[model samples]
Target chain A: MSDVSAHPSLSGYEVPIDSWTQPFWDATATRKLVLPRCADCDRFRWPPGPFCPGCHSQRVEWVPAGDGQIYSFTIITKGDGDQHQVFVPALIEFPEAGGLRLVAAIVETPLAAVRIGARVELSWSHAANATVPVFKIVTL
Target chain B: MKHESAIAGVGATPYYFRGQSAPQTLYEMICKAILAAVEDAGLTIRDVDGLAFYSMGFDSGLIAESLGIPELTFASTVSGTGGGSAGVLDLAAMAVETGRAKTVICVGACQQLQIRYGTAFSHMPVTPEKAWERAAGLTGPGQVFALIARRHMHTYGTRREAFAEVVISSRLYAATRESAIRRRPLSIDEYMAAPMLADPLCRLDFTLETDGAVAFVVTSGERARDLKRRPVYIAASAHGGTCEWGRAFHWLNMPDPIFTTAGSEPIAARLYAAAGIGPKEIDVALIYDHFSPLVIMQLEDYGFCHRGEGGAFVESGAIRINGSIPVNPHGGHLSEAYIIGMTHIREAVEQLRGEAVNQIEGAQFALVTGGPAPIPMSGAILRN
Candidate 1:
């Protein structure tokens, strides 16, 4: 029952929560950004799967995600219609998370200011069902 | 089974802009294309025993029943979208060579009226993999591939000028053909003026949203000799992806090499090995042109040039009609029509038969590729 209607900008975007992804949405609801880390291999699995891709380890633990840098970014100028607002989506790479790159929208920053390797800090936005994790560029 | 099977005929419907094919349903277009292909081969629907398709398969039962297919021996479809376009041809070839079926037909059709491919991913049930993408406002393929395009530009200095060459070159070829949708000559100025949909990707960078269908007939080499057209022998076919290319455009976690590549290196190696010829021997190339930059990336992945040299390769005017290797002579998906990657195959067969509208003189071989999308991205080599 994950909803994005609360965020008017993401009006039609809906993220359905299933058993495998329930824990992830639950953590985000508390305004915490957590990723699934393999207890046996000490590696992180993105999208929160049941087992590790490297070691096939089922032992998983929720760990706090640290700050990340922009690996790639895109400015979406054309969308569904002319009334659609332009937005920037970036792939934020976390060094501490074993080279994990997560998809996050770059908000609160000028579009032209976004670049690869720029540091980004974790932030949250309210959805109808969960808190979606977003990122803001770190100026300092 | 290299060279054991060959393409006997190819056919397609008039490509129309989205919603322009209103009165004609997708199934009707598919049926018409199949009939045209059968007629082109001098055969009837009763002669067809197997059907090979990609994506959703289009309900082969309904197709067989409606088309009055006397008996259906084999029916199968490759997974994923256009990436399996050439792979489906391989399936038909295998069925022919193994004595499972004598003649097989491969088909693909697209109608964007009910569902649009641009924002298709957003409408799907949010799987674990798509949850983050949906939240990040990454809704379409053009927006998603922009990330990869930007990375290529950052790491290798691949410029928009090279992408413009790909679009302009394809349009230039399309302008000469009567069956093509965009038959107007495109200049670099027009490409430069095109509105940017996704950063580094302009309107011309995207493949057209078309309503059309394409079909081709396949049979064993021995049986093809008695057919109506010149036999374009299937020399080799390969389809698969590397481990790092998982979910591809959806997941941006790939490391260096595969990250910047079209993920066609593995497919290319297998194709050349099985065909017993390298890229230089190919007279014409029908590389998939879903996006302008991908054409450059594939030119590298397929060994047309050294890695990261694709930008320079296109800028040198090598992919034009009189260049080293003419690519997409039928205008490809960029300027012709987007029936997935089937149009590339139709163009390949036409080139090998020496019957293409913009025919490459003495075209002995043609290379056709499937999507750079996901695993099992396929390619096939056909020789006259």
Candidate 2:
């Protein structure tokens, strides 16, 4: 069963855990980022399909992601009545991983401070029955 | 074959917002629409021998059983998923032309508000997307289109205000008609001030959580001559999708989709050729407006304007009611109820029959398109 915990600002937080996804979640619990890399094309396939989207290779493995960059983002303002909270939800891109983009929330960062081409590193946030991937803008 | 079948009648339930409307189940809304279509066609339930639909709204067999459509010889559930609204009419027409069924009615029904519509696309449990896609807060339709809109902006330098024309035009049209749920005249300031559901997309860009159902009846041109209303001839109908459009909605890594080509683009040439008319000859158009950028995409895809110039074409007032060509005089999904794309077909039928509330001047050809990219799309050309 999943339980609820509050973040600084974000709504609709539910994480999924299953066989193909358990390792990713387990790694997240330990604070690591991993993705499916194709054996034939040596490119990472996102959303973890059985066959590699690149070269139709079923031989794929979950490997660590070096890093990602913010592709595009949206500022979500959700709540009831007068009480509202704002957070940035973004699609982060891994260049060397064959265009595998991760849809994660940007936490512990001000919405105005986030940039379109901002570089971000992955961090984990525990919620309910799973660990969710959260991102923070990388400072040089 | 071009004029083998025609639309005999169209019907719809009074559209309402989630809580503002009467309490009726999704099935009841569909039944109301289907029965209304049968009555509008001036035919009894016994004459209805065919049924077609998409998105698995409610079982066709059970729907027929409920409607007393006895001995259904033709029943087709289209394969494009929800993007097959235009194709449903084609399938119904196919049934009539092939003599599989004498009278066929295509129906589409959905009550997103009741179904917790938010969870359907976003939460892809029992799949790999559960871990990567939905869990990351990218579940809403607004998110997918936000990505597409941003790409369009990046590629063509399309301004965010370029969508103002579409929003304003649709609301203005809606205000003139009583059936429109979103009748308040929308101003540019209001549109700009609307809260963001997804980046590049404000609340105005998204369609309302509509509760209703729509259906249209199709039969042979010869048989349609004896129906209740003027026969809306189906000059050409076609539908298909891109090469790699999967049933599951994950297209982040795919090469260049949505912005350039559309689900409706693949079948545009064939439909226009079959209709024996060009886009310039079309009196009105009812392109899908589930999102603002898609309306722009369809305008480009259907040859109304050059590629990547959709933003400018709409902003220049070319699509206003009295402009060179009017679009979605019924307000479309943007201001109108989001009955999937079924309402677009219903509006096209009414416009061609010269019965629209915001009727065009003696429209001859009407172009109606169905769902947007990442899914197989469909479209049809109708003549009065």
Candidate 3:
């Protein structure tokens, strides 16, 4: 059985962790964002795939995705008043990471101000022994 | 090119909330429907050689074993796409046409009433890339459709009242069917006053979660001719998909991105071409209504009307039972049990066979469509 009550604060929310995804959460604890990179094709991937989508090679390694540019985003004018009211879900793509994109919420910016192609950097927060990775606008 | 196969028989367990003392498991519901469908066609469970069902279904091995078949040849499980019903229709047609199987059974079952009530994502597989999207609290299927409803209203001046007409009309028809989950007649005023789930989208605009299963048996037309029940030929079927997850910034990147009129255009075009029939030839329709905006999108996509005119078309009450072409005469997902749109296909078969509880007179041709999710979509035209 899974530990349901241990994460009481996240009650009514899903706490997802799997064998392949544990390292990702570990990196987040140190406020770092990491993704699986294909050693053969030298491309980055999200969602911790066992093989590279670019070359379909099983030899892939996890690496840091230092920063990314927003490919697209939505302000989400309506939400259920949990994370929806405060978060701006954006699709961020890393140019140096071979167009690998991740869907993350942008912090420290008004929902209306979030736009496509916006520069952003990775940030992390701790929750129930797990670090949640998020994004914020890059300060130039 | 080979011709598509025919739907030999269709069946369903009584649709009810999961906790209604039904004493039924998901596998049991599937078995009941499969057995009933075989009986309806004057065939035996032993005749089934292959199966196609939703990936979300509870159990496949048990369903197969319960039927006590000697050997199984073909099996496919699908996820993603709200059009589970249309997917089965396509698969059934392919199964028979390819000689892969003599009789293929397609099934869909959901136990939403038994699952703990919180949100739909609770059951969804959460991957690292999807963490941020889920973390922002994007919850159920209705919520995703709600976003498109807002954009549709903003772009086409679609009034809330116009959207409510879909519910009001569907509920009015559903009331005639005793098996429908929501049979009470819904007036425009009551629809407007219903509790809101999403702004501009009221509770009435969403489908209810009920424990149920629907199944169909497909075979070659030559075989269907000798069956006990009327043979509803699978005239045409098609499917399409779009890459809109990363292109959401563009307002046009909403649910159905490929054909601009929603994915309905390609599916409908291919279906009509295969069947040698146009939208006007259809006598009944069962468009998937996970949300009401899709009804409007499908109306335009299926060539029932021009783009941007679906709001007016729905408001005209032309989709009612007595209208030119009755749509969702069984209340649809908005008022009927949400069975991943499989019930819609079952309803079409019933209409064609002249056996629906809320049967429309002389429904020789029926059109059914898939959902507006980012996944692959499908549509079918069934004729008696």
Q: Which candidate tops TM-score?
A: 1
Ranking by TM-score: 1, 2, 3
Whole-model Cα lDDT per candidate? Answer: 0.86, 0.77, 0.71
Q: In terms of lDDT, which candidate is strongest?
A: 1
Q: Give the alpha carbon lDDT tens digit for every residue of B210-290 in model 1.
A: 899999999988888898898889999877777788678877787777889888888899999999999999999999988
- Rank by DockQ (best first): 1, 2, 3
Give the residue spans of candidate 3 off by over 4 A.
A1-140, B79-81, B116-118, B244-262
The Cα error of candidate 2 at residue B151, in Å, is 2.9
Model 3, B49-108: lDDT tens digits are 888865454455777778797677878755654644587778767777888888988888
Writing each residue's lDDT as its tens digit, candidate 2 over B215-248 gives 8889999888988889998888877775544432
lDDT of 1 at A77: 57
Pairwise DockQ winner, candidates 1 and 2: 1
Best DockQ among the predictions, by candidate number:
1
Candidate 2's C-alpha runs over 4 A off are A1-23, A26-30, A53-55, A80-83, A127-129, B116-126, B244-249, B257-263, B273-277
- Compute the lDDT of residue B293 as modeled in candidate 2: 77
RMSD of each: 3.4, 4.0, 6.6
Judged by TM-score relative to the true structure, which candidate is superior, 1 or 2?
1
